[model samples]
Structure formats: C-alpha cells, structure tokens
Target: MTTPAPQPIDRSGFGTTGKFNVSLSKRYNFDKIFSTAAWVATLFGLVVLAVLLVDILIDGLGRIDWAFLTSFSSRRAAAAGILAPLVGSIWLLVVTALVSFPLGVGAGIYLEEYAKDNWFTRLIEINIANLAAVPSIIYGLLGLQIFVRWLQPITNGRSVLAGALTLSLLILPIIIITTREALRAVPDSLRQAGFALGATRWQVIREHIFPIALPGILTGTILALSRAIGETAPLIVIGAVSYIAFLPELSPKGLQSSFTALPIQIFDWVSRPQTQFHTNAAAGIIILMVVLLIMNASAIYLRNKFQRNRP
Candidate 1:
C-alpha cells in the first residue's frame, strides 16, 4: 500500500486540518460568510445610533440654556421654562419607584419560589407575557377608567397617585419577568448549600438568593421607569395638563392640581406656530435623553456592583 502525505500543522487550532475541520471545507463557506455578515450588521446598528444622537445634539444643544432649564411655561418661547415639567417628572419617578418596586419584587418572588410549576402558574405567566405586549395606550385607557375615575374615592381623580399607580401597573410585568430571570440565575448549588446547612426555604431566598438577584431587579426597575418617563398617552388620558406653571408636591391636594411632564410639555411647545417653540421642544427632548441615560447608567453600575459581589 502507498503511504499518504502528512498534513502540515494549522496555526488556528483546528486539529486534523486536512479532513475534520469545517473551516477547511471546499463546499461550505459558513464561517467567513457568517462572521462578515454579523460584523456588518453590528456596524450598521452602531451607525444608526450615532446618526440619531448626532441629529438630536445638533438641533437641541443651542436651545438648552440656563433660562430654559429654570423658567416656567409661557406663551412666549423665551419665557417658557422646563422647571415644572422637570420637577413633575422627578416626582413621577420617585413615586413610581416607591409604589412599584416592593409589589413587583414580592410578586416575582412568590411566583418563582413559592408557587408550584403547575397549570395555574403557567397561566399566570402566559397572561403576564401577553400583558407586556399589549399596546401602552390600552394601559392608558385602564388608567383613565380605573385610576382616574373609578378609584376617585381613593385617589380623588387625576392625582399623581393615580399616574404613579397607572405606570406601576404598566411596568409590573417587566419587573416580574426580570426579577424571575435574576432569581433563576442564582445557582442551584447555592440553594442546595444553604439547605444542607439547615436553612429553611424562606431563609435561602432571603439570604442566599435575593442578594445575588438584587442588581438585576434594580436594572429592570430602572428600565421600566424609563419607559414610564417617556410615555405621554397614559398621562394625557389621565388628564395631565399641558401648561402647568408650578411644581408637583407630594401631598394629596398637590396631586389633585394640574401638572405636566417633559413629553407633554414638549408636545405643547412643538404644536405652536413659533419656530422658537420648536427649538424649545428640541431642548426638552435633549433633557429627557440626558435623564434617561443617567438612570440607565446608574442601573448598570448597580448591576456591575452586584455581579462583582456575587460569590
């Protein structure tokens, strides 16, 4: 029998380069083609994001001055300020966090840890998924009917409490989903260790699992609130005024008074005839973007901290 020639070593670590390596195949060019395609797609997405950021900065930068940040809304574009809208948005974020976080996190723990993986839990899970996809406008309608009107006896109509509750409901599903994912990421070995050490179920979740998952829960909460902050329809349906001059205070009476958010204020300005008002609206957009970026960054920092601390 004739002896075959030995193949030279392939530097890229594909063993037996003459036969077993897929990248050396003549018929299939998958690796090169797929890698190139993936890189192109990633570059395209980055380019799009860069273009959007550039456009917004170019249009809005000059319009954002001290006066714009500090003044109240008025008929004249120069006189209008974002103070009240900024304060209102801040209040909304605070109240929404306070109201939503505990309820959402608790429900998530119950579902993920306490409940059995039976038909009822599955049904609840499916409904939550469906709720997440429902149009935000539908949540707006629910806020209008249930929070703004039906719960008038409790909240007395169109209050910040109502708005917060509406936003809470909208974001609750997101929180639950994210929290569950975080909980699931906790290694089963950790739970087993805790139990083997004579820990109860509650103790395992409280001491061993929750600390590991807290960062993810916080990330989800920030993301959900970001969504709520950008929303206009729900606030509009619940009767957010477009021309409020004063900042929102936390008291019940304060909440009953008229208010505005950044988006609504921007909308009101952009709808006007003056060119300067449009510029003001663009400035408002920039402000909203900055706030969102800050919130997201803080959440990311929290996530990193937790990940670092996790054992």
Candidate 2:
C-alpha cells in the first residue's frame, strides 16, 4: 500500500507552524541596514581620500614647471629649484633597491620553503612580524646609531649610502613579510608535481616557485619602496641636509656631500615664511607623487607581464 503524501504548509498565517516565520520584507530591510552601513563606511573613506588628493592638486599644480623641475636650490625664490633633492631621491631609491632586494628575497625563501614549524622558526616569525609593526622613527634611531656612527667609516656619516642603508632596514621586514606571503600563495600541487618529475628541491624553487612568486615579490618591493620614498622623519633623524644645491654624482666626494630628498626639500620650503617657497614645497610634493606613481605603475606592469609569460 502507498503511504499518504504530507500536506504542504500555507502562509496566510494558516498552516505555518514555526515559532518564527520570517517575512521577506522584514528580512530584506534587516539586510539593507547592514549593507548600507558597510557601503557608507567604504564611501566615507574614499571621499576623504578624494578630498585630500583634490586639495593637493589644487594647491600644487601651479608650482610645476620646466625650470622648477631642473634647477638647483637657491635662497632667492626666483632661483631655487628641486634638482638636488630629486637627484638625492633617485640615489636613495637605487641604493635601497640594490641592498634590500636580494636579502629580502632570500630571507623570504628560507622562511617559506625551508623553515620547519619549530620553536626557533616560530620565534623568528614572531620577531619579524613585530619588527614590521615597530614605528619607522625607531628604525631611524637605530640607523643613526648603526649606520651613521658605528659605520661612519663606511658610509661617511649621514651620506646617501647611510640614508639608503637606513631605509633598507626600515623596509626589509616589510619586503620579507610580503615575499613570504607570496611564496605561501603558490599551490602545493605545483611543488608536488615538480617533485614527482624528479626535480631537486633547489631546482623546484629556482625554476617554478620563484617565477610564480616573482609578481607578488615585485608588488611588495614596490610598496616598500613607496613607503621609503615618502619617509621624512627617519631621513631627518639620520641628518639628511635640507640645503643641498648640487646634484648627487656617483663619486666618493659626491657621496660625502650633504643631500636632501623631495620630502626634506618640501619641509624646508614650507617652513620658510615666503609664499613662493610654499609654492615650491607644493611643487616638490607633486613631483614626489608623480615619481611614486610611476614606480607603482611599473611594478604593476611587470607583475601582469610576468603572469602572462608564466607557463
């Protein structure tokens, strides 16, 4: 004999038997409140960012000109330019990249691909995270002590090399952290496949793992460099001069000469009572922003290209 079919419940408050019957309108309204809150918060942050950029553009655009970009600093408003600081900033970037990239990548590889989940590795991991969180100014102080004083013979006291070394320390932890995350993101199956094909551990990391992780590493390095470029306090603490008048050349004498970066130049200009200097400061800011944007864009392009070239 066939069993009788169960009757379907009706919802005119008739056959519904649950203690709580959720009406669609009530549920929709409840969800709407949360969705609105999330969107509002995101939009608020975006609006603030937009306002800041607009304000900067409005204030700084008038200061940019061909002469302003290429001339050296002077006491007179008509003669002062950003040449020295621009050169100094370029030197800082090149040196920092040279010193930081290999060390950071190596550390990342050690941590991600090789380190076991032992107490020592755990401790190292914890310290690296903590170091990343430490205030940048503290790195400045450490740099002042280590690079400026103890290593003065090598860097010649607050020179471009000293500044680069200091900045490297400041960004090293960040680079390593980003690289480790990138390395970790590669699928385990890829590694397993490499091993299954009789590839050595080193070969697997060198050929397969690095190519996949390269994009992420490059992204992180760019971000780290961006942070380094904008840094003023550490450079100040390391005694980067603000009144440099000549472009930094690649010689020992040039290295020993006083230097200034874009931020330092801007700070110097803004601190002056003259309105023209303030305008110059604004110009320097715009230049700095442009350079940073270009660097970030290049990084993104490299990342995309690498991804497309991946096999």
As a whole number from 0 to 100, the lDDT of residue 264 in candidate 2 is 90
Model 2 per-residue lDDT tens digits across residues 1-311: 99999865675663454422556567789899999999999999999988988877887798788888889889997778888899999989988999999999999999899888999999999999999988989999999999999998888899998899899999999999999999999999999999999999899999999999899999999989999999999999999998876777787667665688998999999999998888788778889999999999989998999999887
| TM values, all candidates | 0.87, 0.89
When summed lDDT is taken over every stretch of 10 residues in candidate 1, the lowest stretch is: 19-28
Model 2: CA > 4 A from native:
1-31
Local accuracy of candidate 1 as per-residue lDDT tens digits, 235-262:
8888888887777767757656556789
RMSD of 2: 4.0
Alpha-carbon lDDT, every model: 0.87, 0.89
Show where candidate 1 strays beyond 4 Å.
1-38
